[model samples]
Target: MLAFAAGFIVRPFGSLVFGRLGDMSGRKHTFLITIVLMGLPTFIVGLLPSYATIGMAAPIALIALRLLQGLAVGGEYGGAVTYVAEYSTPSNRGFNTSWIQTTGTGGLLLSLFVILGVRTLTGEEQFASWGWRIPFLFSIALLGVSMWIRLKLKESPEFEKMKVQGTRSKSPLRDTFGNRRNAMTVLLSLLGCTAGLGVVAYTSQFYVQFFLLQTLKVDGRIANEVLAIALVLGLPFYVFFGWLSDRIGRKPVILTGCLLAAVTYFPIYKSIAHYANPQLEHAHTMAPVTVYAPPGECSLQFNPVGTASFTRSCDSAKAALARNAVPYSTVAQPPGTVASIHIGEQVISAVDGKGLSRSQFAAQTAAFDAQVAHALASSGYPATAVPADVNRPMLVLLITILIVYLTMVYSPAAAWLVELFPPQIRYTATSLPYNIGNGWFGGFLPATAFAMVAATGDIYYGLWYPVVVASCTFVIGLVFLPETRFAAAAKISSARASTN
Candidate 1:
């Protein structure tokens, strides 16, 4: 998790560096550099030694590699978007750039298919042990193909015109951030546009997968297959929304998507739970669970990688329940009382492991957990999602709706963003806001949502994170972000023509 977060954290710096390079040099070459940077790290990860073979060094190297990939991605997206928009006619900008939008979901669908194929071929045990690397290793061939395609492409026509006219900015960073007007635009773009779009992107696609595999305990293969199908169904909507935006407007489509996502996320997620794991959903209501413990003994346990030592009895009880996706209420007991969980009529006490030796602690903890598991089972909690109870078609429909929302926000975004800035320092200006919104706001979503669920003991509480973000985006964007369908593009064209 930390390694993944590292990639997101350093993305802004990459945006700053590569964005400037793209502006000062040319969009085509800078993005080509970024592709190589991203591809090499991804390919190396497959060949890198595992933790068992290299100890701490393996993870450290992994984190470093992730950072490099993040940096490249930060630079890569802005350049690609700018390149596509610049090459396109103003009338076709939204439609053409929407093809670029498809890549995000399209890549996800492709990766899922590849892994599903590899897993089916290799079998579960081998796939878990070694076949996992095949997907990452396969990136090398993709990199080669991408490079070949990109190499044959010409420079952006708008950028070439700017160079011919000698209107390019000498210092893209200063021109972008040092000016008050441009800086304000950047701030508004983050708050009213990219931030909301970023959260929705992750919430719809990535978080659903997490919810299924981790919280609902759905079988990995089944979950992947269903999600892949939903993605395929949802794929064409990106172009549809982009085409729609061309006729209507970008602002309305984007803000509408945000509004819809904010309003519907909770119910959508609940429906997902009900369909994906009917047994768990039934147990949640039929057998209400609660925790009673001394005040301050329970912590909002966020031990990613399962390494944190939650020694208090209350903390242990809550963590155990959270791991099993059992929603429960909490009640404070007297100071000296031990922590206990109540599932219907059954009561199971937890031991405080703080003062015990390692061996004693493990034994006691195991015994306590077994008791809780048994109690939960008796109260109708299934260990895993029952295949017979899963409503696969409904799950696909709900997920497709989510991706549709994603498309509305993301489809016309490239053209919208391009029109937000002038050609002088467009790359630097566009990349910063986009990366911050996605890298900081969107990237932290899964971790933040998981922590919220763990703390509140409501499996659905985590959804509030995206809800709030999308709501803010809808409100801010409605009032602040300008409609950039035709006016801004015309303004930019005239600005370029004036220099000529």
Candidate 2:
């Protein structure tokens, strides 16, 4: 958990540092630096030892790499998008920068494909132990290729023009912040534009990937296959929407996507649950379970690292059931009393203790976990989702629709954001809000939603996070966000031209 949080926690700081560099220096130079920075750490992450092998040092090393990756990515997007947007005339800004958006989706698909291919070659059993590193190691070649491509690129014409005209920002930070208008626009961009898009984009991709593996217990192979197919099918829509925005408007397309995600998330996820894990859905209704404990005794079900043991019965019982994806309501029992799990008509008593040795505790917890797993399996709950029973075509369709929502919010985002700020402070002004939205708001979706699901024992409850965020963005964007394609850039250009 701390490691994951570390990845996001450093992004805003990275944006601050690299955004300054991008704005002051050439966009090509700064992003060239960022790409190298990002690629090296990613390559090293593949080589890092696991926790079991190196203890605390392993996680620490991984955390450091993640932070580095965060920093690189934080600065990388702004420069990349700004470079593309500046190269594009107003007529093609949305369409051209939409290709940048495709890289994100395409990169994810590429990585997934490479992983599956590697796993297939290495065989499934060996892949987990040693083969996982191949993809990360392969990033070195990609890094070399990326460096080559970046080397050939020229500084953006717009930025170059501004520099030659003696209109470059002396201090991008001060210029962006000293003025109330830019600050207010940046703030609104966060609340309305990036925040909503972040939630929608991440929830569709990362959260759905998580739901398939962890919640549905679907085989990783099938999930990846399905996702890759959906991505390929839905991938063109990113460019289509971006091109569409040029004709219609950025706000309408983006906001419509947000509203669509907000309204349909519940049913979409519910359908996914039904088609992907039909047995779990049926068993949940047929043999429901409830856990009883003292009101405040149950610990929150969020321990990403396995070091902490939720030894208390209230915590242990819920953890066991939650791991197996068994939905259970918590019942309040007498304070300080031992916990109990009521499965349909059967009641299972939990072992209680005020103090116990570590060995004794582990043994007790292991036994308790086994007991709960047995009870759930016996009550017709699946141990892991069976692939043969799934409605594969329907699952693909649902995930494809989710990807469509992703494209709606993400496709035109770069062009829209680029249009929000001027050539002088564009990199710094836009990067902060964009990174904050994705890094902080979107990055934690899986952990946050999983916690919500664990706490409530309702898998669908987690959808509320994205749904609420997207809905808020819809309303906020409608009111505060400006139409950036035609008027926004002119306004920013005039404002900056006057100031500089």
Candidate 3:
């Protein structure tokens, strides 16, 4: 968990470090180094021993590897966006920069496919044991390809021009912050524009997947397949909107996404609820499963990876139903007794937590969860919405709409951010806000939403997080963010005019 958190906490710092290198050394070489740093640690993570195997050293090593990834990603994006934007003209900058957005989705699709294939070949049991390592180890091949491609690339014209005239800032960091105008511009963009974009984009992809498997209670494999296909169907829109932005302006396309999400998320997810568990919905109308457990015995269901455990029998059983995204009301009982889960005429006794060691308790809870899942599935509660029962056509359309919103926000974001800062300190200025919004605002969604749902006992309530953030962006972005479609060209022209 500390390792995962490092990915968020260290990104702003990484942005500062790598941003300075790009400004001083040049984008191509600096980002090349970042790719190496990222890829090497990714490959090494596969080889790291687990906590069970190496005790304290295992977690420490994992945290270090994750930090390396965070650092590499932090520095890498600024260089990339700057490189692409520098080469683009005012007329088609959005269209060209859209490829960056497209490539990210493509990369996600590729990585997921690879992991799925490996899991399929290894079988779920074996995959859980050791097969997960293959995907991480596979990063080395991609790292090699990335290095070769980047090596063949030449430097951006903008950076070359700056170096030729001896106009590059000796202290890019100082210049970026000391110029209050530029500093404030980046800050506003982060909070008002990119922060919202971060949430929308992450929610569209990652949170959607979470809802399907964790909330809608879809089979993990089935959920993944559905997402992969949807991603494929929607991949082209990233570039499409990029072209559209070139014609209409970035502000409208981006804001429209936020607006669409803010207004329509409840419905989109409501539709998912209907498709994923029509039976549960029907049963829910007739009778909701009510859990009766002792106070503090039934812990709220919030399972962050590598953090928090539900140990008591009541907590474990309650968590099981919640993990499957079942809506249940709790009735408090006395302390230390087993939970009784009531479903219509049937009552299932929860596992007893007494007289068991820690490992034994964990094993007992795992069995208890499986039993509850089975009982629920047997009693007209779908573990996953049956393929035939699902509203496939609407599901596809909803998924596509969600992905479209993602493209709307993300397609022009890089170019807009690049345009926000002057070339000399562009790398430094752009990296900080971009990474912070993505790393913190976007990355924090799952855990935050988990808490929200747990507290309210409504599966859909967690969506308020994104809805609120996107709305804030929609209003602020409209009012404060300048039309940066031609910002780069304007800056370049001003530089040339001064020289003349």
Candidate 4:
């Protein structure tokens, strides 16, 4: 998760740098640079040596490259969306810009197909060792195609008009953030719209991947196949919602999606567990687990940098339970008392590793863990999800519903953002909040949710993170975000009238 978030941390910087360039230069040119920036690092990743070969330098280099990729992506969306919106008719803006939104799902679908193909051709052992690089190396081919398409692209009409009229902002960063009103709009956009959408997007897609593999113990192949099917089934809804936003309003569609996701996430995830791993769910209900620990002994278990040592007995017990995706409740005991896990009729004592040597601690920890595993197995917790028991069709359907919600909130977002900002500083204004929302709010979600789940010892407790974020977005967007559809059309009409 830390590695996954490395790119997100630098996305805003990419937005600012590339966004400023887009506002000053032409959108066509800025994106051309961004495409190369995005592609080269990806290609390099495929070829880069592992830690065994390059020592500590390998990970450091990977992090640096990931940061570059994030920056490129930050700049890419705003330029693409703003360009499309600038060229589109006011009546058709939502539908046109929605096509841009579809690219994400399309790209995901394509990558999944490629990965499956590579995995099949190379075999599991080879794929795990070196075949993974095939996907990353393939990015070079995509880069060439993108570069070709973008090179022939013309400057957006609005940008050309601003250039001819000398109406472009001399200082976009200052105009975007230094001005109080524009800055407030940026903040509202982040909180009320993009932040909510970002969380929903990650929860439905990336977090689901983690939950399936780590929590549900679903097979990697099955999980990927299910997700791919859901994405394919739900792809059309992007266009549907975008078109709907044109008729009704962006605010309504977006807010409705947020509301639906917030209200249904719990049930949807519960249904997923029921279908994906029925045995685990059954075990959870039948042999409910608890940890009895001393007061204030357990740590939060959020090791974002991956450096924290959870050596205390309470911490050890809770961490093991969380790693197994087992839901548990902690009962406070007296100070200095050791922690113990109660799984049905079995009682397993947790060992404190504070004073033991490394080898001694490892031996004790292994014995303790073995005992707990034995208890869990006796209580009917399966080591992995049974392929025969998985309700594949039902899982696909539930996951599709999640993607539909993602599409509803995301499809109209580009058009709405373009309409919100003036052409002079549109790229700069749009990219900042969008990247911040996705990069920070969405990117950090998995790590944050994992920590929450670990701390609480509730398998489903992590879900509250997205539900709360989406709900907040619903309320703030309802009150603050204007209907940009009407406002944008009116602006166009007024501009034409003056020209006439």
- Best candidate per lDDT, number? 4
Pick by TM-score: which candidate is best? 4
- What residue pairs clash in candidate 4, if any at all? none
lDDT of 3 by residue, 311-331 (tens): 666766566666778777778
lDDT: the better of candidates 3 and 4: 4
Off by over 4 Å in 3: 50-53, 290-305, 309-320, 329-379, 487-500
Candidate 1 lDDT over 247-352, as tens digits, reads 8878888889999999999999999999999898789789999999886766766544335677788877887888788999989899878888999988888888
Which tens-of-lDDT digit does each residue in 1-500 have in candidate 4?
Answer: 45667788889999999999999988999999999999999999999999999999998999889989999999998999999999997688999999899998899899989999999999999999999999999889999998998888899988998899999888889999998988899899999999998999999988888999999999988999999999999999999999999999899999999999999999999999999999997898899999999959988887765666789999889888888888889899999999999999888889899889979888998888888888999999988999999999999999999999999999999988888888878999999999988888888888788889988988889899899999999999999989999888888799899999
lDDT of 2 by residue, 30-146 (tens): 999999999999899889988898999998898888889889888988989999998886667888988989987899999888887898899978898999999999899999999
**TM-score-based ranking:** 4, 1, 2, 3
Clashes of each: 0, 0, 0, 0
| Per-model CA lDDT versus the true structure | 0.89, 0.87, 0.83, 0.91
- Greater TM-score among 2 and 3 belongs to 2
- Per-candidate TM-scores read 0.94, 0.94, 0.88, 0.97
